[model samples]
Target: MKALTWQGINELAVKKVPDPHLQNTHDVILRVRRSVACGSDLHLLGGYIPAMEKGDVIGHEFIGDVVETGSGVQKLHVGDRVAVSSFMACGKCWYCKQELYSLCDNANTNPAITEALWGHAAGGCFGYSHAMGGNAGAHAEYIRVPYADGTAFVVPDSVADDRAVFASDAGPTGWMGADRGGVKEGDVVAVWGAGAVGQVAARASELLGASRVIIIDRFPERLALAGQFSEGVETLDYSQVDVDDALREMSGGRGPDVCIEAVGMEAHSEGVQNAYDQVKQQLRLQTDRTTAAREAIYSCRKGGSVFLLGVFGGVVDKFPLGAMMNKGLTVRGAQMHGPRYIPMLLERMARGELRTELFGTHVMPLADAPKGYELFKEKKDGCVRPVFVP
Candidate 1:
């Protein structure tokens, strides 16, 4: 089997590796049908994630077919199509009971809430940097997925792999943010960044009944795509226009009722890179990548909610905390608890309420991952969301 291994900053190579097998009773062996590069993978590649180890399989969102399942995995069987969750968690945990599966007690209740109340601490993560349970990754030909029946969701066979791919991460993350924002009919929504996550956020807002969606992105290409997914959505090229002014003008002197920040950790600082970075050879730090987050805060209406859906690991500066507090802005950040949303999102997609297919611009093979990662990092090649089909 071959998997893209992270050798160092901006260094990735396809190397022959041993295939994974069922390791735990709660585990499943998934054959990779499709996978894609996530922005978080860039963080790990750039050495921004401290605990990342060389040779760690680094990808989180992917849709796969179940090749085998452990004895305890009854919900899924071999040959079932499934979307793997970003995090593996036991279903019987205390937090899982509350729908806060990301903070599952038996998984990683670090602060100590009593073993009976919390259960066992987390053992590790799949494809995420070392700190999260370094449990291999799905970027390979096959992945050994733990907490299989508890989190692995069977994606509908009717949907194309590329369309269902984002369901593993961005699709559900977007839905979670829109749901958290409580988008209602006639709500003026603004999504900052036209990245995959941002695109999904805009589409999710539409599904949630936002009347006039406005998507802001500096990239004309992405903004154009954003306009297409959102119903008559006004596009703000923040590079050319003042975000606060444009958002205010569109909202009749008020700011957007709901603002979704999909630009994540890039919202903070330029993710300080070491001098040894070769990514710097092809990429120079564009400071505005850091501005859109604060811009999301600035363009938000008073008393409105700002939902952040980007990846983060380090400290950042220049956020308008005083303004957020003064205007009573509610801000929340999350990784999509996909297991909670996949079933419902599937139903919506089945009914055509969620138009995920429009957002997929590229469906290349897994072998072109370097090009995919480069373009995704540069927002080149009309890259909306690139899926790697193996």
Candidate 2:
């Protein structure tokens, strides 16, 4: 099997690797159909997340067909079309019972590494890093899926492969962002970043009854896509104007009711704080850039909620705890619980209520994955997301 392997910082290669086999009684092997690069993958490529090693396969968002299943997998069988969740969970666990699948106690195979860094292990994710379970990623011909009954959702015939592929990660992550942000009827919501997650977050906000949704970014193409795809949604170019002032003025002196930070550790901005963060990051003193996070906190309405869907690996320097304390802001964040939202998102997609197909701006074969990553990372040719068909 040929898979995309991480060689070093900013280095990726397609090479032959051993095919995966069922290792657990509840496991199944999936012949990957469609897999896409995620914004979070950029963090991995940039060496923001640690514990990755040479030759580690790296991808999480994908859909496939079940080729083989263990004896314990009764619900799924060979030839079943499925979308594997990015994270694995045991449905019987305590956290899983609460529908917090990402925090499941029984998934992470490398618990010691995570417990050292995060005080406890959350869940095993496919092809993220060694710290996240070291599971082989889906940017390959096939992958082994554990807890298949709980993690792999059967795709309906009505939903196309292009749309169903996102249910694995991006769609659910964005849905979780809006759901956790506490979007309500007539609430004003603002989302930072115009990537797939940000676009879906804005759309989800509208579906959840937010009267006005604002998306912030520096790219004209992404902002235009957000404006065209999401109804009642507006776009803001942060490079042209002061984001805080523009948001405040747009809201008539009151900040947005909810602010979502979809841009993660690698956020870019122009100013002193960005320069400071860049210096610290280059020196290995800190692993995150907090420009978007700071703006999100400062621009949120008093007593409003700020949701973080972006991936932050390490401690940040000079976070505004004062703003959070003085303004009475509610801060919430989580890794997406795919099992909890994938079904609902699939139903919405099947009913034509959600439009995710527009996100697939570039499609390429598995061998062209290196070129795809280059295009996506550089944002060349208005590329939003590049999907690879294996």
Candidate 3:
């Protein structure tokens, strides 16, 4: 098997690797059909997330067909086309029973590492990092999926592979952001970062009855695409104006009812704070750039909710706790619970109520994954999300 492997900071390679075999009674081996690079993958590639090692396979968003299943797996079998969740959970766990799959207590093999960093360990995630779970990712020919019954959902025939692939991560993540952000009828929602997650968050806000959706970004192509695909969505070029002032004007002096920060630790910004964050990040004094997060908090309406859909690895400097306290704002965030929302998203896709095919702007073979990553990371040729057909 050939898979993308992390060699060093900003280094990736495609190399031959041993094929995966079922290791647990509930495990299955999946022949990957399609996989895509996620914005979060850049964290690992950029050395933001810790505990990653040389030669670690790195990808989480993917869809595949079951080639073999353990005897304990009853619901899924050979030849079943499935979309595996980015994270793994045991459905019988207490958190799982509460539908908080990302916080499942039984999945993370490296709990001590995460517990030291976050006060608690999250569930195992495919190909994220050693701290999340060292499971091989789907950017390969095949992968071993443990807890197959809980993690792999059979894709409906009506949903094309291109669309179904996103159900594994991006779609469910955005849906969770909107759902948890408490989007309501006629609410005004603002989302930062017009990438896949941001685009989907805006669309999900509309689906959940937000009357107005505003997407913010510096990229013209991404903003244009978001406005085009998500009906009623408006775009704001932060490069041209102060996002806070723009939001104030757009919302008629009141801030957005909900503000979502979809750009994570690597967020870029203008002015002195951006340079400060960059220098601090390079010195390893801070692990995140909080520009978008700060804007989200400051731009949100008083008493409104701010949802964080972006991935953050470590502590940030100069956070706006004062605004959150003074304004009585509600802040919520999570790693997406795929089992909680993948089914609903799939149903929407089946009914043609959701469209994600346009997100796959670049499609390449597995052999060309290195080039795909370069294009995606550099945002070359307007690459939004590059899908690798394995």
Candidate 4:
């Protein structure tokens, strides 16, 4: 099988690797049909993710067709179309029962979900890092899917595979970020970083009936997508215009009622030249993903809510916490629990209530992944969300 392997810092290649076979009764085999590069992949690309090992496969969001199922897997069968969540959890864990799937006790107990009897924090995840169970991810011809019945959501036939791809990660992630903001009808919303995730968050706000959606980004291309997603949304080009002024104007002299920080530690801000300077002297692709997260806090309306959906594993510099406290705002971060929303989001996709495909400005084959990462990092226009076909 040809797996998109992350060999080391700033290193990636399509290499032939061993195929994944069933390792446990609950395991299943998936032949990946499609996948995409996410901003998080920059962590792997820049070697910022600490748990990652050399030669690790590093993508989390993907969908595949089931080629085989383990004996204990009853909910899924061969030939089923499914979207795999970034994380896996045990159905019967303390956290899983509470709907905090990331904290699933059983999933943390073992390297492979069904191979052991206790809990470990490392849930079996594909294409993540060594700390995430070191499993090969969906950036391959075929991947071993653990806890298939728990993590893989059966995508409906009504949705095209291109659109269905986002449900695995960015789409639902954006949906979850917006929901975490607790947006209400006619409320004002501001979203930072108009990348695929940020664009979707603004769209989610629109779906929730937000009266105004303000998007912040230096990249005109993604901000344009935010505009296309909703007429209510206004763009703030952080590169040219001042964000504080833009937010004040858009929110009637106040900041947005709800602010979503879709760009996490990967965000770039003023003063910091590049986020990856510690790892290498190269220009940091993660700068936009992290720096934008901090700006959302400063630009949020007083007493508003801020949701942090972007991935930031390490320390970030220049976050203005004093302003957040004085503003009396609520700030939180999250990872999307696909099972919680994939079915509903998929239903909405079926109904056309979510036109997230507007963010899919580019779609190419899996072989073009390295270029996709480069383009996404550069914020290339007409390539908002690029999916790779294997």
Candidate 5:
């Protein structure tokens, strides 16, 4: 099988690898149809997240056809087109029962690594890292999908592949940000980062009945796309305007009721703090950049909520604990619990409430994944999200 593999820090390649087969009673072998690059993949590409190895396949947001199914798989069979959640969860677990599927106890087969790192393992995600189960990623012709019945959802006939592919990760992840961030009717919501995740987060806020949705980013192209999310959506070019003042003005001098930070560890900011974060990250003193998170916390209204939809692997420096505590704000972060939101998101996609194909700004064959990653990583040619076809 041909798949994209991590060669080294800031390196990727297309190489032939062994094909996958059913590994568990609930597993299924999927012939991947589409897999999109995610912002979080950059962390792996840049060697920010530990436990990644040479030649490891590294993609998780995907849609595919089931090629083989294990005996215990009841809802899926050969030839079914489905979108699989990035997070793997055993449906019978306590966390799964509580709809916090990402915190499932039985998913991460390689638990000791993350358990040692974060005190406990959450769940396994395909192709993320050895710390997240070391499962081969979906950026290939085929992948082994464990817990198929719990993690895979059949794509509705009304939804196209490009649109359904996002339901695998970005859609659910963004929805989680707004849903868990406590977006309410008539609430003013602000989202940091206008990438795919941020775009979706803004749209999710609109769908959740936010009276206004403000998306912040420095890129002109990304901000332009975010502006078209909905009538209630607005975009702020962080390079041109002071985000703090602009958000306060938009929220009637009170700051937004909900703030979502969608940018992850590679988040860029200006000035001395940015330099400090960069040096600390390069020196391995901290594993993430908290610029967006700090800005979100600072910009959120008193008694408001902030949700972190971004992926952060390790400890970060200079988090805004004082403002968060003094303002009586609610702060939460999570890897998306896909099972709890994917079905509803797909239904929304079917109804044309969520249009995500536009996020696939660059489409290419699997053989060209290295170039695609270069374009995506550099944010070159207005690449929002690169979609790779297998």
Candidate 6:
């Protein structure tokens, strides 16, 4: 099988690898049809997330056809088309019972690493490195999906492959931030970053009845895309305006009711702070960047809430704990629990309430994955997400 592999830091290659088969009683073998690149993949590409190894296949947002199914897989059939969750979970676990699938106890195959890093192990994520179960990713001709009935959702006939694929990750992730960030009717919401997740978060806010949604990014293309898909959504190019002042003006003197930081550990900024963060990161002193997060916390209304949808691997410098504590704010962060939101998102997609096809700015064959990844990583040619057909 031909699969995209991580050769080293900032490196990717499409190489032939061993094919996957049924590995567990509830496992299913998916013949990958559409697999897309995620901004989170950049962390692995840049070696920010530890436990990544040479030649590991890397992709998690995808939709595929079930070519084979294990005996215990009752919900899925051999020919069912499905979108699989990026995080693996055992539906019977206590965390899973509470609908916090990402915190499932039986998912991460290698628990000692994360247990040591964060005091508890999170659920496994496909191709997210050895620390997250080391499961083979979907960026291949075929991939193994464990806990098939619990993790894979059948894509509705009304939804296209490109659109349904996002229900696997970005859609669910963005929805999680807005739904959990306390977005309410008539609330004002601001989302940091204009990537797929941010754009989706903006739209999710609107669906959740937010009166106004604001999406921030330095790139005009991404901001434009956010406005296109989201009704009544405002966009701010962070480089051109003072974010705090702009947000305050938009929210009628008060800060936004809810602020979402989706830029994650690789967040970039301008001026002295950017250089300081860069120096610290390069010196191995800081594992994650907090430019967007700090701004989100500082710009949020005193009684408002902030949710982090971005991926952060380790310790960060200069988190705004003071403002968060003083302002009576509610701050939360989580990896998306796909099972909790995917079904609703898929139904929304089927009704055209969520438009994700626009995010697939570049689509190509699996052989061009290296080029697709390069374009995606560099944000070149206005490529929002490069979708690969394997």
**Residue-by-residue lDDT tens digits, candidate 5, 1-390:** 999999999989999999997778999999999999999999999989889999999999999999999999999989999999999879998899999999889989999998898998979999999999899999999999999999999999999998999999999999899999999899999999998888888998998899999998988989888766555688888878899999999989999999999998888997788899999999989989989999999999999999999999889899889999999999999999999989998999999988899899998999999999999999999999999999
Task: Give candidate 4 misplaced runs (Cα > 4 Å).
Answer: 108-124, 270-290, 380-382
What is the TM-score of each predicted model, taking all chains together?
Answer: 0.88, 0.98, 0.99, 0.89, 0.99, 0.99
The residue pairs in collision within model 2 are none
Q: Give the TM-score of candidate 6.
A: 0.99
Q: Which stretches of candidate 2 lie over 4 Å from their true place?
A: none
lDDT (tens digit, per residue) of candidate 2 on 204-252:
9999999889999999999999967787789899989888898888787
lDDT for each residue of candidate 4 in 1-390, tens digit (9 for 90 to 100): 777788788778877888889989888898887888887877778766656776776688888999999999999999999988877866877777777665556654335532332233544556777656677888888888878888888888998887788888887788888887899999999888787788788888998989988887777667767767766778887778778887888789988889898776655655445534333323442233356666678888889998998876644445678988999989987666667777788888888766766666677777887777777767665566667778
Cα RMSDs, all models: 4.9, 0.9, 0.8, 4.1, 0.9, 0.7
Candidate lDDT scores, in order, read: 0.74, 0.92, 0.92, 0.76, 0.92, 0.93
Task: Please give, for residues 172-291, the per-residue lDDT of candidate 1 as tens digits.
Answer: 888888887778888999988787778878888877788888887777888877766666667877657767888898898989999988876554322343222223322543212335
Which residue ranges in model 5 land beyond 4 Å of their true spot? Answer: none
Error of 6 at 225 (Å): 0.4
The residue ranges of model 1 lying beyond 4 angstroms of the native Cα positions read 108-125, 267-290
